[model samples]
Target: MNTTTEDTDDRARRSIGARRNPASQEAILDAAEAVLEESGIGGFSIEAVARRARAGKPTIYRWWPNRTLLMLDVYRRFKNARGFPDTGSVRGDLIALLQNHLLGFWKDSLCGTVYRAIIVEAQNDPDAAKALYAYQEERKKATEVIIERAKARGEVAKDVDGRLIIDMVVSFAWHQLLINRLDEAMGSIEGVVDGVLMGCAGYKR
Candidate 1:
Protein backbone atom coordinates (compact mmCIF):
# COMPACT_ATOMS: atom_id res chain seq x y z
CA MET A 1 0.00 0.00 0.00
CA ASN A 2 1.26 3.43 -1.00
CA THR A 3 0.03 6.78 0.22
CA THR A 4 -0.92 9.31 -2.44
CA THR A 5 0.15 12.96 -2.14
CA GLU A 6 -3.49 13.87 -1.47
CA ASP A 7 -3.68 11.36 1.37
CA THR A 8 -0.47 12.65 2.86
CA ASP A 9 -1.64 16.23 2.58
CA ASP A 10 -4.97 15.40 4.23
CA ARG A 11 -3.20 13.70 7.12
CA ALA A 12 -0.85 16.61 7.57
CA ARG A 13 -3.71 19.12 7.64
CA ARG A 14 -5.78 17.01 9.99
CA SER A 15 -2.86 16.53 12.34
CA ILE A 16 -2.22 20.27 12.44
CA GLY A 17 -5.89 21.10 13.00
CA ALA A 18 -6.06 18.54 15.78
CA ARG A 19 -2.95 19.59 17.64
CA ARG A 20 -1.19 22.74 16.51
CA ASN A 21 1.62 23.00 19.03
CA PRO A 22 4.42 25.51 19.33
CA ALA A 23 6.90 23.00 18.01
CA SER A 24 4.85 22.54 14.84
CA GLN A 25 4.49 26.28 14.42
CA GLU A 26 8.21 26.72 14.89
CA ALA A 27 8.92 24.01 12.35
CA ILE A 28 6.74 25.73 9.74
CA LEU A 29 8.42 29.07 10.38
CA ASP A 30 11.82 27.43 10.18
CA ALA A 31 10.88 25.87 6.87
CA ALA A 32 9.59 29.24 5.60
CA GLU A 33 12.89 30.91 6.39
CA ALA A 34 14.82 28.13 4.75
CA VAL A 35 12.65 28.28 1.63
CA LEU A 36 13.03 32.06 1.34
CA GLU A 37 16.76 31.81 1.84
CA GLU A 38 17.10 29.07 -0.74
CA SER A 39 14.64 30.20 -3.40
CA GLY A 40 14.24 33.92 -2.80
CA ILE A 41 10.71 35.36 -3.07
CA GLY A 42 10.27 34.17 -6.64
CA GLY A 43 10.52 30.57 -5.57
CA PHE A 44 8.80 30.92 -2.21
CA SER A 45 5.35 29.39 -1.95
CA ILE A 46 3.00 27.46 0.33
CA GLU A 47 3.86 24.26 -1.47
CA ALA A 48 7.57 24.90 -1.08
CA VAL A 49 7.25 25.54 2.65
CA ALA A 50 4.93 22.57 3.15
CA ARG A 51 7.33 20.27 1.38
CA ARG A 52 10.21 21.60 3.40
CA ALA A 53 8.41 21.23 6.71
CA ARG A 54 6.66 18.01 5.81
CA ALA A 55 3.45 19.95 6.16
CA GLY A 56 0.45 20.43 3.87
CA LYS A 57 -0.50 23.50 1.86
CA PRO A 58 -3.78 23.70 3.78
CA THR A 59 -1.90 23.70 7.08
CA ILE A 60 0.43 26.48 6.00
CA TYR A 61 -2.55 28.45 4.71
CA ARG A 62 -4.40 27.89 7.96
CA TRP A 63 -1.41 29.30 9.79
CA TRP A 64 -0.28 32.17 7.53
CA PRO A 65 -2.92 32.52 4.77
CA ASN A 66 -0.44 34.19 2.41
CA ARG A 67 3.24 34.27 1.61
CA THR A 68 3.52 37.88 2.76
CA LEU A 69 2.07 37.02 6.15
CA LEU A 70 4.35 34.06 6.48
CA MET A 71 7.36 36.10 5.39
CA LEU A 72 6.48 38.83 7.90
CA ASP A 73 6.24 36.21 10.63
CA VAL A 74 9.61 34.83 9.65
CA TYR A 75 11.05 38.36 9.80
CA ARG A 76 9.25 39.26 13.03
CA ARG A 77 10.13 36.08 14.90
CA PHE A 78 13.86 36.69 14.62
CA LYS A 79 13.43 40.39 15.33
CA ASN A 80 11.54 39.74 18.56
CA ALA A 81 14.12 37.18 19.54
CA ARG A 82 16.87 39.74 18.88
CA GLY A 83 14.93 42.39 20.86
CA PHE A 84 15.69 46.11 20.79
CA PRO A 85 18.51 48.21 22.22
CA ASP A 86 18.73 50.76 25.07
CA THR A 87 22.19 52.25 25.36
CA GLY A 88 21.17 55.11 27.72
CA SER A 89 21.59 58.02 25.29
CA VAL A 90 19.26 58.38 22.33
CA ARG A 91 22.23 58.62 19.99
CA GLY A 92 23.63 55.38 21.34
CA ASP A 93 20.26 53.70 21.15
CA LEU A 94 19.64 54.87 17.61
CA ILE A 95 23.10 53.85 16.52
CA ALA A 96 22.70 50.48 18.17
CA LEU A 97 19.38 49.90 16.42
CA LEU A 98 20.84 50.88 13.08
CA GLN A 99 23.87 48.69 13.62
CA ASN A 100 21.73 45.76 14.72
CA HIS A 101 19.67 46.11 11.57
CA LEU A 102 22.21 47.16 8.96
CA LEU A 103 25.40 45.52 10.17
CA GLY A 104 24.07 42.79 12.40
CA PHE A 105 21.17 40.61 11.29
CA TRP A 106 20.33 42.37 8.02
CA LYS A 107 23.83 41.79 6.75
CA ASP A 108 24.92 38.66 8.54
CA SER A 109 21.74 36.64 8.96
CA LEU A 110 18.54 35.48 7.22
CA CYS A 111 16.66 38.62 8.33
CA GLY A 112 18.08 40.69 5.48
CA THR A 113 16.87 38.21 2.93
CA VAL A 114 13.49 37.82 4.58
CA TYR A 115 12.91 41.58 4.86
CA ARG A 116 14.08 42.18 1.34
CA ALA A 117 11.57 39.64 0.14
CA ILE A 118 8.83 41.40 2.08
CA ILE A 119 9.63 44.72 0.44
CA VAL A 120 9.53 43.14 -2.97
CA GLU A 121 6.28 41.41 -2.23
CA ALA A 122 4.75 44.66 -1.08
CA GLN A 123 5.42 46.18 -4.47
CA ASN A 124 3.18 43.73 -6.27
CA ASP A 125 0.59 42.62 -3.73
CA PRO A 126 -1.81 45.13 -2.21
CA ASP A 127 -2.42 42.89 0.76
CA ALA A 128 1.28 42.53 1.15
CA ALA A 129 1.64 46.29 1.09
CA LYS A 130 -1.04 46.64 3.74
CA ALA A 131 0.54 43.95 5.84
CA LEU A 132 3.92 45.59 5.43
CA TYR A 133 2.45 48.94 6.46
CA ALA A 134 0.86 47.45 9.56
CA TYR A 135 4.06 45.63 10.43
CA GLN A 136 6.09 48.83 10.03
CA GLU A 137 3.65 50.69 12.25
CA GLU A 138 4.15 48.16 15.00
CA ARG A 139 7.91 48.45 14.64
CA LYS A 140 7.68 52.25 14.50
CA LYS A 141 5.71 52.28 17.73
CA ALA A 142 8.42 50.21 19.36
CA THR A 143 11.15 52.52 18.06
CA GLU A 144 9.12 55.54 19.19
CA VAL A 145 9.73 54.42 22.76
CA ILE A 146 13.39 55.27 22.28
CA ILE A 147 12.47 58.82 21.36
CA GLU A 148 10.01 59.06 24.23
CA ARG A 149 12.78 57.97 26.59
CA ALA A 150 15.05 60.66 25.16
CA LYS A 151 12.32 63.23 25.67
CA ALA A 152 12.10 62.24 29.32
CA ARG A 153 15.83 62.77 29.73
CA GLY A 154 15.78 66.13 27.91
CA GLU A 155 17.76 64.60 25.04
CA VAL A 156 15.08 65.28 22.44
CA ALA A 157 12.74 68.21 21.91
CA LYS A 158 9.40 68.08 23.68
CA ASP A 159 7.81 68.97 20.38
CA VAL A 160 9.79 66.61 18.23
CA ASP A 161 7.85 64.14 16.14
CA GLY A 162 9.19 60.69 16.93
CA ARG A 163 7.47 59.21 13.90
CA LEU A 164 9.35 61.56 11.57
CA ILE A 165 12.64 60.66 13.16
CA ILE A 166 11.78 57.01 12.78
CA ASP A 167 10.87 57.61 9.15
CA MET A 168 14.23 59.17 8.40
CA VAL A 169 16.10 56.40 10.12
CA VAL A 170 14.00 53.67 8.54
CA SER A 171 14.19 55.24 5.10
CA PHE A 172 17.97 55.35 5.32
CA ALA A 173 18.09 51.72 6.35
CA TRP A 174 15.67 50.71 3.59
CA HIS A 175 17.76 52.47 0.96
CA GLN A 176 20.87 50.68 2.15
CA LEU A 177 19.13 47.32 1.98
CA LEU A 178 17.75 48.07 -1.48
CA ILE A 179 21.13 49.03 -2.82
CA ASN A 180 22.98 46.14 -1.18
CA ARG A 181 25.18 48.60 0.71
CA LEU A 182 24.46 47.60 4.28
CA ASP A 183 28.15 47.30 5.13
CA GLU A 184 28.99 50.77 3.88
CA ALA A 185 25.91 52.12 5.62
CA MET A 186 27.45 51.18 8.99
CA GLY A 187 29.94 54.05 8.71
CA SER A 188 27.07 56.51 8.40
CA ILE A 189 24.81 55.37 11.24
CA GLU A 190 26.22 57.81 13.78
CA GLY A 191 26.14 60.63 11.28
CA VAL A 192 22.49 59.92 10.48
CA VAL A 193 21.59 59.86 14.17
CA ASP A 194 23.41 63.13 14.76
CA GLY A 195 21.62 64.82 11.87
CA VAL A 196 18.23 63.69 13.15
CA LEU A 197 18.97 64.78 16.70
CA MET A 198 20.39 68.10 15.63
CA GLY A 199 17.35 68.81 13.44
CA CYS A 200 15.11 67.94 16.33
CA ALA A 201 17.14 70.07 18.78
CA GLY A 202 15.33 73.31 17.92
CA TYR A 203 12.19 71.79 19.36
CA LYS A 204 13.79 71.28 22.77
CA ARG A 205 11.96 73.02 25.57
Candidate 2:
Protein backbone atom coordinates (compact mmCIF):
# COMPACT_ATOMS: atom_id res chain seq x y z
CA MET A 1 0.00 0.00 0.00
CA ASN A 2 1.03 3.62 -0.52
CA THR A 3 2.06 5.83 2.42
CA THR A 4 -1.22 7.76 2.57
CA THR A 5 -3.31 4.58 2.37
CA GLU A 6 -1.24 2.96 5.09
CA ASP A 7 -1.71 5.99 7.38
CA THR A 8 -5.45 5.91 6.80
CA ASP A 9 -5.60 2.20 7.60
CA ASP A 10 -3.61 2.72 10.78
CA ARG A 11 -5.94 5.50 11.94
CA ALA A 12 -9.01 3.37 11.23
CA ARG A 13 -7.62 0.52 13.27
CA ARG A 14 -6.76 2.84 16.12
CA SER A 15 -10.30 4.28 16.17
CA ILE A 16 -11.76 0.78 16.31
CA GLY A 17 -9.41 -0.16 19.10
CA ALA A 18 -10.29 2.96 21.10
CA ARG A 19 -14.03 2.40 20.73
CA ARG A 20 -13.92 -1.31 21.47
CA ASN A 21 -11.27 -1.12 24.17
CA PRO A 22 -11.06 2.02 26.29
CA ALA A 23 -8.07 0.48 28.06
CA SER A 24 -6.07 0.82 24.88
CA GLN A 25 -6.56 4.58 24.84
CA GLU A 26 -5.60 4.83 28.51
CA ALA A 27 -2.54 2.66 27.93
CA ILE A 28 -1.36 4.84 25.07
CA LEU A 29 -1.77 8.02 27.11
CA ASP A 30 0.03 6.47 30.04
CA ALA A 31 2.91 5.47 27.81
CA ALA A 32 3.06 8.89 26.20
CA GLU A 33 3.30 10.49 29.64
CA ALA A 34 6.14 8.17 30.62
CA VAL A 35 8.08 9.05 27.48
CA LEU A 36 7.53 12.77 28.13
CA GLU A 37 8.70 12.53 31.74
CA GLU A 38 11.76 10.47 30.86
CA SER A 39 12.91 12.38 27.75
CA GLY A 40 11.22 15.78 27.88
CA ILE A 41 9.73 17.43 24.82
CA GLY A 42 12.57 17.11 22.34
CA GLY A 43 13.01 13.39 22.95
CA PHE A 44 9.39 12.28 22.52
CA SER A 45 8.76 9.88 19.64
CA ILE A 46 6.26 7.21 18.57
CA GLU A 47 8.80 4.44 19.13
CA ALA A 48 9.63 5.59 22.66
CA VAL A 49 5.96 5.90 23.59
CA ALA A 50 5.11 2.53 22.03
CA ARG A 51 7.97 0.87 23.87
CA ARG A 52 6.84 2.34 27.16
CA ALA A 53 3.18 1.52 26.53
CA ARG A 54 4.07 -2.00 25.32
CA ALA A 55 1.98 -1.40 22.26
CA GLY A 56 2.89 -1.43 18.57
CA LYS A 57 4.41 1.67 16.99
CA PRO A 58 1.58 1.67 14.49
CA THR A 59 -0.89 1.89 17.34
CA ILE A 60 0.74 4.98 18.77
CA TYR A 61 0.96 6.63 15.38
CA ARG A 62 -2.58 5.61 14.56
CA TRP A 63 -4.03 7.17 17.71
CA TRP A 64 -1.89 10.31 17.79
CA PRO A 65 -0.67 12.08 14.72
CA ASN A 66 2.32 13.50 16.63
CA ARG A 67 4.04 13.62 19.98
CA THR A 68 2.56 16.98 20.91
CA LEU A 69 -1.00 15.75 20.42
CA LEU A 70 -0.18 12.67 22.46
CA MET A 71 1.18 14.78 25.26
CA LEU A 72 -1.92 16.99 25.13
CA ASP A 73 -4.10 13.89 25.43
CA VAL A 74 -2.09 12.72 28.40
CA TYR A 75 -2.53 16.07 30.09
CA ARG A 76 -6.28 15.95 29.57
CA ARG A 77 -6.39 12.47 31.04
CA PHE A 78 -4.33 13.46 34.06
CA LYS A 79 -6.47 16.52 34.76
CA ASN A 80 -9.68 14.55 34.51
CA ALA A 81 -8.36 11.79 36.72
CA ARG A 82 -7.60 14.20 39.55
CA GLY A 83 -10.97 15.96 39.32
CA PHE A 84 -11.71 19.36 40.94
CA PRO A 85 -12.36 20.57 44.48
CA ASP A 86 -15.31 22.62 45.68
CA THR A 87 -15.74 24.38 49.00
CA GLY A 88 -18.82 26.40 50.00
CA SER A 89 -17.30 29.88 50.15
CA VAL A 90 -15.24 31.60 47.49
CA ARG A 91 -12.20 31.97 49.72
CA GLY A 92 -12.39 28.36 50.78
CA ASP A 93 -12.95 27.25 47.21
CA LEU A 94 -10.04 29.27 45.88
CA ILE A 95 -7.75 27.98 48.58
CA ALA A 96 -8.81 24.41 47.95
CA LEU A 97 -8.37 24.77 44.23
CA LEU A 98 -4.97 26.44 44.49
CA GLN A 99 -3.75 23.93 47.02
CA ASN A 100 -4.84 21.05 44.85
CA HIS A 101 -3.11 22.61 41.85
CA LEU A 102 0.09 23.24 43.80
CA LEU A 103 0.17 19.72 45.18
CA GLY A 104 -0.42 18.26 41.75
CA PHE A 105 2.40 20.31 40.28
CA TRP A 106 4.86 19.71 43.11
CA LYS A 107 4.16 16.20 44.38
CA ASP A 108 3.98 14.56 40.99
CA SER A 109 7.36 14.75 39.29
CA LEU A 110 5.87 13.39 36.11
CA CYS A 111 3.14 16.04 36.11
CA GLY A 112 5.62 18.81 36.74
CA THR A 113 7.92 17.58 34.01
CA VAL A 114 5.12 17.20 31.50
CA TYR A 115 3.75 20.64 32.38
CA ARG A 116 7.11 22.25 31.77
CA ALA A 117 7.38 20.44 28.48
CA ILE A 118 3.95 21.70 27.48
CA ILE A 119 4.89 25.26 28.41
CA VAL A 120 8.01 25.05 26.27
CA GLU A 121 6.09 23.57 23.38
CA ALA A 122 3.45 26.27 23.66
CA GLN A 123 6.13 28.89 23.19
CA ASN A 124 6.73 27.74 19.61
CA ASP A 125 3.70 25.71 18.61
CA PRO A 126 0.47 27.51 17.80
CA ASP A 127 -1.66 24.44 18.40
CA ALA A 128 -0.11 23.84 21.80
CA ALA A 129 -0.58 27.49 22.62
CA LYS A 130 -4.24 27.26 21.71
CA ALA A 131 -4.68 24.20 23.88
CA LEU A 132 -3.05 25.95 26.82
CA TYR A 133 -5.30 28.94 26.30
CA ALA A 134 -8.38 26.74 26.30
CA TYR A 135 -7.29 25.06 29.51
CA GLN A 136 -6.77 28.42 31.20
CA GLU A 137 -10.11 29.66 29.95
CA GLU A 138 -11.85 26.69 31.50
CA ARG A 139 -10.11 27.36 34.80
CA LYS A 140 -11.10 30.98 34.63
CA LYS A 141 -14.72 30.03 34.17
CA ALA A 142 -14.66 27.88 37.27
CA THR A 143 -13.10 30.67 39.27
CA GLU A 144 -15.67 33.08 37.93
CA VAL A 145 -18.47 30.93 39.24
CA ILE A 146 -17.00 31.10 42.73
CA ILE A 147 -16.68 34.87 42.51
CA GLU A 148 -20.24 35.19 41.34
CA ARG A 149 -21.42 33.17 44.29
CA ALA A 150 -19.51 35.47 46.59
CA LYS A 151 -21.10 38.46 44.96
CA ALA A 152 -24.55 37.01 45.46
CA ARG A 153 -23.74 36.54 49.13
CA GLY A 154 -22.54 40.13 49.41
CA GLU A 155 -19.03 38.92 50.25
CA VAL A 156 -17.61 40.50 47.12
CA ALA A 157 -18.47 43.59 45.10
CA LYS A 158 -20.99 42.97 42.37
CA ASP A 159 -18.99 44.88 39.76
CA VAL A 160 -15.70 43.14 40.48
CA ASP A 161 -14.17 41.32 37.58
CA GLY A 162 -13.74 37.68 38.49
CA ARG A 163 -11.55 36.99 35.53
CA LEU A 164 -9.03 39.63 36.59
CA ILE A 165 -8.92 38.30 40.14
CA ILE A 166 -8.56 34.73 38.89
CA ASP A 167 -5.71 35.82 36.64
CA MET A 168 -3.88 37.44 39.50
CA VAL A 169 -4.32 34.50 41.83
CA VAL A 170 -3.16 32.09 39.13
CA SER A 171 -0.17 34.27 38.27
CA PHE A 172 1.00 34.37 41.88
CA ALA A 173 0.57 30.64 42.40
CA TRP A 174 2.22 29.77 39.12
CA HIS A 175 5.24 31.89 39.92
CA GLN A 176 5.58 30.29 43.33
CA LEU A 177 5.11 26.80 41.93
CA LEU A 178 7.73 27.35 39.21
CA ILE A 179 10.28 29.01 41.49
CA ASN A 180 9.80 27.03 44.70
CA ARG A 181 8.17 23.84 45.94
CA LEU A 182 4.46 23.65 46.82
CA ASP A 183 5.12 23.24 50.53
CA GLU A 184 7.17 26.38 50.50
CA ALA A 185 4.40 28.19 48.63
CA MET A 186 1.46 27.05 50.79
CA GLY A 187 1.88 29.89 53.24
CA SER A 188 1.27 32.47 50.52
CA ILE A 189 -1.93 31.14 48.96
CA GLU A 190 -4.22 31.99 51.87
CA GLY A 191 -2.89 35.49 52.18
CA VAL A 192 -3.15 36.07 48.46
CA VAL A 193 -6.73 34.87 48.35
CA ASP A 194 -7.65 37.01 51.34
CA GLY A 195 -6.04 40.11 49.92
CA VAL A 196 -7.84 39.71 46.61
CA LEU A 197 -11.12 39.17 48.40
CA MET A 198 -10.59 42.25 50.52
CA GLY A 199 -9.83 44.33 47.47
CA CYS A 200 -12.93 43.10 45.69
CA ALA A 201 -15.05 43.70 48.77
CA GLY A 202 -13.84 47.25 49.07
CA TYR A 203 -14.82 48.06 45.53
CA LYS A 204 -18.02 50.12 45.22
CA ARG A 205 -20.45 47.97 43.29
Candidate 3:
Protein backbone atom coordinates (compact mmCIF):
# COMPACT_ATOMS: atom_id res chain seq x y z
CA MET A 1 0.00 0.00 0.00
CA ASN A 2 1.39 3.37 -1.12
CA THR A 3 0.14 6.59 0.43
CA THR A 4 0.77 9.37 -2.04
CA THR A 5 2.12 12.74 -0.86
CA GLU A 6 -1.19 14.41 -1.70
CA ASP A 7 -3.10 11.87 0.40
CA THR A 8 -0.66 12.30 3.28
CA ASP A 9 -1.05 16.08 3.17
CA ASP A 10 -4.83 15.75 3.01
CA ARG A 11 -4.89 13.51 6.05
CA ALA A 12 -2.71 15.92 8.00
CA ARG A 13 -4.91 18.86 7.10
CA ARG A 14 -8.09 17.05 8.04
CA SER A 15 -6.67 15.83 11.32
CA ILE A 16 -5.23 19.15 12.35
CA GLY A 17 -7.65 21.69 10.89
CA ALA A 18 -8.06 24.25 13.65
CA ARG A 19 -5.07 22.92 15.54
CA ARG A 20 -2.85 24.15 12.73
CA ASN A 21 -4.90 27.20 11.88
CA PRO A 22 -7.05 28.88 14.53
CA ALA A 23 -8.84 30.77 11.81
CA SER A 24 -10.46 27.52 10.68
CA GLN A 25 -12.09 27.05 14.10
CA GLU A 26 -13.58 30.52 14.00
CA ALA A 27 -14.74 30.00 10.40
CA ILE A 28 -16.46 26.78 11.40
CA LEU A 29 -18.23 28.52 14.28
CA ASP A 30 -19.28 31.37 12.01
CA ALA A 31 -20.67 28.90 9.48
CA ALA A 32 -22.47 27.05 12.24
CA GLU A 33 -24.05 30.25 13.44
CA ALA A 34 -25.16 31.08 9.90
CA VAL A 35 -26.62 27.60 9.42
CA LEU A 36 -28.53 27.94 12.70
CA GLU A 37 -29.87 31.34 11.76
CA GLU A 38 -30.88 30.24 8.27
CA SER A 39 -32.24 26.76 8.96
CA GLY A 40 -32.80 26.53 12.71
CA ILE A 41 -31.96 23.14 14.21
CA GLY A 42 -33.90 20.96 11.77
CA GLY A 43 -31.71 21.86 8.80
CA PHE A 44 -28.42 21.91 10.69
CA SER A 45 -25.99 19.03 10.30
CA ILE A 46 -22.26 18.45 10.65
CA GLU A 47 -21.99 17.76 6.94
CA ALA A 48 -23.79 20.98 6.04
CA VAL A 49 -21.72 23.02 8.42
CA ALA A 50 -18.50 21.41 7.23
CA ARG A 51 -19.41 22.23 3.62
CA ARG A 52 -20.17 25.81 4.51
CA ALA A 53 -17.06 26.18 6.65
CA ARG A 54 -14.74 24.38 4.22
CA ALA A 55 -13.73 22.04 7.00
CA GLY A 56 -14.13 18.35 7.53
CA LYS A 57 -17.08 16.95 9.49
CA PRO A 58 -14.57 15.20 11.75
CA THR A 59 -13.13 18.57 12.67
CA ILE A 60 -16.48 19.82 13.90
CA TYR A 61 -17.20 16.58 15.72
CA ARG A 62 -13.84 16.80 17.39
CA TRP A 63 -14.81 20.14 18.93
CA TRP A 64 -18.50 19.68 19.65
CA PRO A 65 -19.65 16.07 20.22
CA ASN A 66 -23.17 16.75 18.93
CA ARG A 67 -25.29 19.23 17.05
CA THR A 68 -27.05 20.35 20.20
CA LEU A 69 -23.76 20.97 21.95
CA LEU A 70 -22.45 23.00 19.04
CA MET A 71 -25.62 25.03 18.87
CA LEU A 72 -25.45 25.61 22.61
CA ASP A 73 -21.91 26.91 22.30
CA VAL A 74 -22.98 29.28 19.54
CA TYR A 75 -25.89 30.59 21.60
CA ARG A 76 -23.70 30.89 24.67
CA ARG A 77 -21.31 33.12 22.82
CA PHE A 78 -24.13 35.17 21.33
CA LYS A 79 -25.71 35.77 24.72
CA ASN A 80 -22.37 36.46 26.39
CA ALA A 81 -21.68 39.14 23.83
CA ARG A 82 -24.34 41.34 25.46
CA GLY A 83 -24.30 39.71 28.93
CA PHE A 84 -26.37 40.64 31.99
CA PRO A 85 -26.24 44.31 32.73
CA ASP A 86 -24.75 46.03 35.83
CA THR A 87 -26.00 49.59 35.51
CA GLY A 88 -25.61 50.44 39.25
CA SER A 89 -29.32 50.15 40.06
CA VAL A 90 -31.35 46.93 40.15
CA ARG A 91 -34.18 48.42 38.11
CA GLY A 92 -31.86 49.93 35.51
CA ASP A 93 -29.84 46.74 35.33
CA LEU A 94 -32.90 44.56 34.84
CA ILE A 95 -34.25 46.88 32.22
CA ALA A 96 -30.95 46.89 30.36
CA LEU A 97 -30.64 43.12 30.38
CA LEU A 98 -34.24 42.36 29.41
CA GLN A 99 -34.45 45.16 26.89
CA ASN A 100 -31.33 44.02 25.08
CA HIS A 101 -32.54 40.44 24.97
CA LEU A 102 -36.13 41.29 24.00
CA LEU A 103 -35.06 43.70 21.31
CA GLY A 104 -33.03 40.93 19.72
CA PHE A 105 -35.98 38.56 19.99
CA TRP A 106 -38.35 40.99 18.28
CA LYS A 107 -35.85 41.57 15.48
CA ASP A 108 -35.55 37.85 14.69
CA SER A 109 -31.88 38.01 15.43
CA LEU A 110 -29.76 34.90 14.92
CA CYS A 111 -29.56 34.43 18.67
CA GLY A 112 -33.32 34.64 18.89
CA THR A 113 -33.79 31.99 16.21
CA VAL A 114 -31.32 29.68 17.91
CA TYR A 115 -32.88 30.35 21.32
CA ARG A 116 -36.41 29.55 20.16
CA ALA A 117 -35.17 26.45 18.42
CA ILE A 118 -33.45 25.30 21.61
CA ILE A 119 -36.67 25.78 23.55
CA VAL A 120 -38.63 23.68 21.08
CA GLU A 121 -35.99 20.98 20.98
CA ALA A 122 -36.05 20.75 24.74
CA GLN A 123 -39.72 19.83 24.65
CA ASN A 124 -38.95 16.41 23.13
CA ASP A 125 -35.31 15.74 24.00
CA PRO A 126 -34.59 15.04 27.63
CA ASP A 127 -30.88 15.79 27.26
CA ALA A 128 -31.71 19.06 25.58
CA ALA A 129 -34.34 19.77 28.18
CA LYS A 130 -31.81 19.32 30.95
CA ALA A 131 -29.35 21.59 29.26
CA LEU A 132 -32.05 24.15 28.64
CA TYR A 133 -33.20 24.02 32.23
CA ALA A 134 -29.66 24.46 33.49
CA TYR A 135 -29.18 27.47 31.26
CA GLN A 136 -32.49 28.95 32.39
CA GLU A 137 -31.48 28.46 35.98
CA GLU A 138 -28.24 30.27 35.31
CA ARG A 139 -30.18 33.24 34.00
CA LYS A 140 -32.43 33.08 37.01
CA LYS A 141 -29.43 33.23 39.30
CA ALA A 142 -28.18 36.31 37.53
CA THR A 143 -31.43 38.12 38.29
CA GLU A 144 -31.36 36.74 41.83
CA VAL A 145 -27.94 38.24 42.35
CA ILE A 146 -29.33 41.63 41.44
CA ILE A 147 -32.06 41.26 44.03
CA GLU A 148 -29.58 40.21 46.67
CA ARG A 149 -27.47 43.23 45.87
CA ALA A 150 -30.51 45.46 46.32
CA LYS A 151 -31.23 43.83 49.64
CA ALA A 152 -27.70 44.43 50.81
CA ARG A 153 -27.91 48.05 49.77
CA GLY A 154 -31.14 48.58 51.68
CA GLU A 155 -32.91 49.14 48.38
CA VAL A 156 -35.12 46.09 48.72
CA ALA A 157 -37.65 45.48 51.47
CA LYS A 158 -36.50 42.90 54.02
CA ASP A 159 -39.96 41.38 53.98
CA VAL A 160 -39.98 41.02 50.20
CA ASP A 161 -40.17 37.51 48.82
CA GLY A 162 -36.82 37.08 47.09
CA ARG A 163 -37.78 33.82 45.52
CA LEU A 164 -40.96 35.31 44.19
CA ILE A 165 -39.06 38.30 42.83
CA ILE A 166 -36.75 35.96 40.95
CA ASP A 167 -39.68 34.10 39.48
CA MET A 168 -41.41 37.30 38.55
CA VAL A 169 -38.47 38.56 36.51
CA VAL A 170 -37.56 35.22 34.97
CA SER A 171 -41.14 34.49 33.97
CA PHE A 172 -41.56 37.98 32.59
CA ALA A 173 -38.44 37.56 30.45
CA TRP A 174 -39.58 34.19 29.16
CA HIS A 175 -43.08 35.55 28.47
CA GLN A 176 -41.64 38.36 26.42
CA LEU A 177 -39.55 35.89 24.47
CA LEU A 178 -42.55 33.69 23.83
CA ILE A 179 -44.85 36.49 22.69
CA ASN A 180 -42.07 38.56 21.00
CA ARG A 181 -44.17 41.50 19.93
CA LEU A 182 -42.29 44.56 18.65
CA ASP A 183 -44.92 47.11 17.69
CA GLU A 184 -44.09 50.30 19.51
CA ALA A 185 -43.77 48.45 22.79
CA MET A 186 -42.71 51.16 25.17
CA GLY A 187 -40.50 50.56 28.21
CA SER A 188 -41.85 47.07 28.59
CA ILE A 189 -39.08 45.78 30.85
CA GLU A 190 -39.40 48.95 32.87
CA GLY A 191 -43.07 48.24 33.30
CA VAL A 192 -42.42 44.70 34.48
CA VAL A 193 -39.73 45.69 36.95
CA ASP A 194 -41.69 48.66 38.27
CA GLY A 195 -44.79 46.61 38.86
CA VAL A 196 -42.94 43.73 40.46
CA LEU A 197 -40.90 45.91 42.77
CA MET A 198 -43.94 47.90 43.80
CA GLY A 199 -45.68 44.77 44.89
CA CYS A 200 -42.68 42.86 46.27
CA ALA A 201 -40.62 45.63 47.78
CA GLY A 202 -43.22 48.33 48.27
CA TYR A 203 -41.19 50.52 45.95
CA LYS A 204 -42.36 54.13 45.53
CA ARG A 205 -43.25 55.30 41.98
Q: Give the Å shift of residue 83 in candidate 1.
A: 0.8
Q: Please write out the lDDT profile of model 2 over residues 94-164, one tens digit for every residue.
A: 88767776444445556665666676788898877888888778867865787888788887879989889
lDDT of 3 by residue, 1-205 (tens): 2766676566555644634344455577788988877886779988889888877788788886667767876787677677677778878866765667555443446666667677777888887788888877786776677777777889887777776787876676656556765433435767777887765465577
TM-score of the candidate numbered 3? 0.72
Positional deviation of 46 in candidate 3, in angstroms? 2.3
Clashes of each: 0, 0, 0
Which residue ranges in model 3 land beyond 4 Å of their true spot? 1-27, 37-42, 62-65, 102-108, 158-163, 182-187, 200-205
Best of the candidates, TM-score: 1
Tell me the TM-score of each prediction against the true structure.
0.82, 0.72, 0.72
In model 1, what is the error at residue 41, expressed in angstroms?
Answer: 4.4
What count of clashes does model 3 give? 0
Give each model's whole-structure lDDT.
0.84, 0.71, 0.70
What are the per-residue Cα lDDT tens digits for candidate 1 across 100-148?
Answer: 8545569988788778888998999988899999999999998888899
lDDT of 2 at 114: 65
Clashing pairs in 3: none
lDDT of 2 at 7: 64
The CA-based lDDT of model 1 is what? 0.84
CA shift at 24, candidate 1, in angstroms? 3.6
Q: State the lDDT at 64 in candidate 1.
A: 78
